[model samples]
Target: MTHKIAILGASGYTGAELVRLIATHPSMEIVALAANSKAGMAYEDVFPHLRHLALPDLVKIEEIDFDNVDLVFCGLPHATSQSVIKALPKSVKVVDLSADFRLRDPEEYVKWYGGQHDALECQAEAVYGLTEFYRDDIKNARLVAGTGCNAATGQYALRPLIEAGVIDLDQIILDLKCAVSGAGRSLKENLLHAELSEGYHPYAIGGTHRHLGEFDQEFSAIAGRPVKVQFTPHLVPANRGILATVYVQGDAQAIYDTLQKTYADETFIQVLPFGKVPSTRHVRGSNFCHIGVSGDRIEGRAIVTAALDNLTKGSSGQALQNANLMLGEEENAGLMLAPCFP
Candidate 1:
C-alpha cells in the first residue's frame, strides 16, 4: 500500500532531503510539493542535483489538495508550522521539521522561540520525534515534532549515560560543530565562501542556543531531575553533518557499555569501538549516527562523541523514520542507504 505524501517548504535543504530519500521509497509517493516563496518553479530549478527525479513542481501550500496526502512533511521555518499545521486536515499525519512544536511546555516554546504557540491543541498532542527514544509514542501519533539537529546529535551521545546514571549530570558539557547547511538554504554574509571556507567559530555560547531547551527538557525528564547541560554550537565550513563532543564525569567503559546496549537493536545508530572516535565525514549524507567513547586524560572523566548528517539523521531522515512508525511501515524502510564516505 503506497502512501501519498506532500512536502511543505519543499525548496529548503531539509525539504529537498526528504524528496531525495523518498524518491526511492517502496511504499511512499510524493503527490505535492509546496514552497510558497518559490511557487510555480520546477523543483529541479531550485535544487539542480535532484533534477533526475521527476518531482512535483513547487506550489503554494494553499494550492495543495490535502485530501490526497496521507502525510505532510512540514519543513517550514520556525514559528511558521504552527499556523499552517493548525489548518491542515485532521486525517493527514504530520511530521513537522520546524521548532514550533518541539518544546512540550507552551511557556518554554515562547521563551526560546520568542512567541506564544498559535497551535496549542496540536502542540499538546504532538509526540517528540527522537525516533529511538520516542518510538512507541511516534507509532501512535498524528503529529510528531522533529528535533533540532544539534539537539539530536547531543542527545544520542548523552541520553544513555543520563538514564543509566553513568555520568555526573551537573558536570555535563556539550560542544558541537555543525555544518552550514543546518542553517538552511538562506544566504548570509558569514556563510559566503570568502568568509566561511577558512574559519569556524562558535555561536549560541554560554547556554544561549535554542537547542538547550530540548536538552533541558529531554535530559531532565530522563534523569528525573533538572539536568542542565552546558551546550555551545559552532558553525563549520562544511555543507553537511554535526559532530557533538560531550564531556562527562563517568566511568569510560561503563558509558561505552551503556550506549552500546541502548543502541544494540537500533538500525540507524552505530556505537563505535571504545577508545575510538567518530567523524562527520563517516556519516555524511546518511541516516546513520556514529558514536564513540574514550577516557579523558583526567581521571573520572570521559568524552563521548557523536556524528551524523544534520540534514539526514538530525532532521529529514529522522522525520521519515518517525513517519514510518506512524504509518505502520517497517521503521527502516527508505532509510537504509549507506553513508556517503570519502
Candidate 2:
C-alpha cells in the first residue's frame, strides 16, 4: 500500500532531500509540499535541481488537508514545528527534522532553544529518532524527533562504546567538521562563497554548541550518570557531509568489536575495516554512515571517526527511515541506494 506523505518546509535543504529520496520510494508518495514563505510558487523554482520531477506546488501549511496525509515530515525550523505540529491531525505520523522536540525535558528545551515548548503533550509522547537504537519505539510512535545532524554523527560513533562501558565517559571528546549546507539554505555572511570557500574554523567551542544538549541527554541516559563530552564543531567549505573524530580512552579493539556487533544488522550503518578511516566523500548524497576506529600510539587512547551526508543520513534520510517503521513498511524500503562515489 502506498502511503501519502507531505513535506513541511519544502523550500529548505532537508525538504528538497526528502523530495529527492521519496520520489523513488515504492511505498511512499508526496501529496503536498508546504513552504509558507514561498506559497503559491512552484517547488522547482525554489530548488532547481529537482525541476525534473513533477511535484505539488508550494502551499501555506494551513492550506493542506492533514487528514489525507499518512505521514508528515516536519522540516521546519526549530521552535516552528512545535506549534505547527500541534495543530496537525493526530492520525498522521510526524517525523520532525528540527531541534524542537529532541530534548525530553521542557527546561532543557527552553535552555537551549530559548523558549518554552508550545506543544507539551506532543513532546511528552515523541520518541527520539535515532533509527538504529530506537527502532521499536519508532514503530509505535505518532511523533518522532529527528536528531541534530552533528549530534547524530557524534552518537553514531559513541553510543555503542558508551552502552558497553568501553570508554571513559568523563574524558570523551568530539571534534567535528561540518559542510556548509548543514547551516540550512538560508543565507548568512559566514556561509557565503567569498568567506567560506578557502578556510575552516571552529565556532561553538568550550562546550557551547546547541547539540551538546543532545549529547548530554542521550549520553547521560545511556551511562546512567552525567556524561558530558567536550564537543567542538567546525564549518568546512564542502557542501554535504559531517566527519566527527571522537577521542576516547578505551581498548581500541574492544570498541571496534562493539560497534561491529551493534550495527551488524543495521542496513544503513557500515563499520569500515579496522584502521580504515571513513571519508565524507564516500558517503556523500546517501543514507549511509561509515564508521572507522583506530588505536593511538599511546597506551590507552583510541580514535573513532564517523562520516555521513549531513543532509541525508543525518536528517531527511533519517526522517524517512523512521517514517517507514511508523507506517509498517519495510524498514529499508526506498533507503537502499548505494553511496554516491566519484
Candidate 3:
C-alpha cells in the first residue's frame, strides 16, 4: 500500500513543504523531486533542513519516470502547472498546488488568470481540493486542485454560515493578510528583505484579487445564488501564515453557534470558544485552521476570524489531505503533527 509521490517544482516553499510532510507519511514516499532550474542538485543542498532525509536528486519534470509514481504534487507556477500536469502519466493521481485547475469555468479562468486554460480536459475533471467540503469528491478524483490560501482562509470563516442560511448573502467582506512565503520561492522585486520588512500594503483591492473567483464560485453555489464579497488581500512581511477577518451580517450569537456546530466533527478545523479570537502563530506549521467569532458593535453584524499557516493548511498540507483521500487512507494520517510554537 505504499504510494510513491513526486513533487514537480521541489525548490519552492510549497514543494519543500510537501517533502517535509510526506517524509512522515506512513503510506507515502517521495520517489522523485523535480526543479527545472535546480535539476541534478541534491534536495538537501537547496533545503538544508531536509538534509537528514533520504530523497531523490532534483530532476526536470520531463526527465521523471511517471511509470513508477503513484501520485504527483504539481507545485509549479500558475500558468506552468497546466501544461506540466497534462503531460504527466494519466494513471498518476495529481494534487496541483497551482491555480491551473481550481476554477471550474474556462471563461472564469481566462477572466481571472488572463489566458485560456491549456488543459481544458484536465480542468473539466479536476476536483476542488477544499478537503472538508469536497472530501467525497477528492477521494475519487484523478486530479485535485488545491484552494488558494486566501480563499481557504475566507471560506473557513463564511462557508458554514452560508450553508446554514445564517448570514446575509450580500454583506460579506474578507480582509486578509498573508505572509510573503505565499508569493512562492520565485524572486520578486517587492519580496526582497529590504523592501518587504517594516512595510505592508494591500493589493488587488475592490474585488480584483484572483482568489475572489473562488469565493464567488463557492459562496454563490452554497447560497444558490450569486454571492460576491468585497475582498482585499494585504502582503505582510512574515514568512508563513494567513489571517482573515470576515465581516458578515447576521445575529452574532447565531453565527458563532453555526460555526461551532459545523466544525465539531472536523479534525483539522478548530472553532475557538466564542468571543475568543485566534492568532496565526497558534496554527503555524500545522494543517489545522482556527476560527473565532465575536459580535460587532452593531447587533446584526459579527466578525469572524480564521488563521492557518499559508504553506501548511493553505497549500501543501491541504494537497496531502486530498492525496490521502485519493489513496483511501485516513484523512488526517501524516498530518497530525502539532503546530510549531514560538
Whole-model lDDT, model 2: 0.94
Residue pairs whose backbone atoms clash in candidate 2: none
Candidate 2 lDDT by residue in tens digits, 132-192: 9999999999999999999999999999999999999999989999999999998799888
lDDT of 2 at 161: 97
User: Which whole-number lDDT from 0 to 100 does residue 67 have in model 1?
Assistant: 92
RMSD of 2: 0.8
Error of 2 at 288 (Å): 0.6
Segments in model 3 whose C-alpha atoms lie over 4 Å from true places: none
> Which consecutive 10 residues in model 2 have the weakest lDDT in total?
332-341
lDDT (Cα, 0-100) at 273 in candidate 3: 90
RMSD of 1: 0.7
lDDT of 1 at 104: 94
User: What TM-score does prediction 3 earn?
Assistant: 0.99
**Stretch of 10 with least lDDT, candidate 3:** 204-213
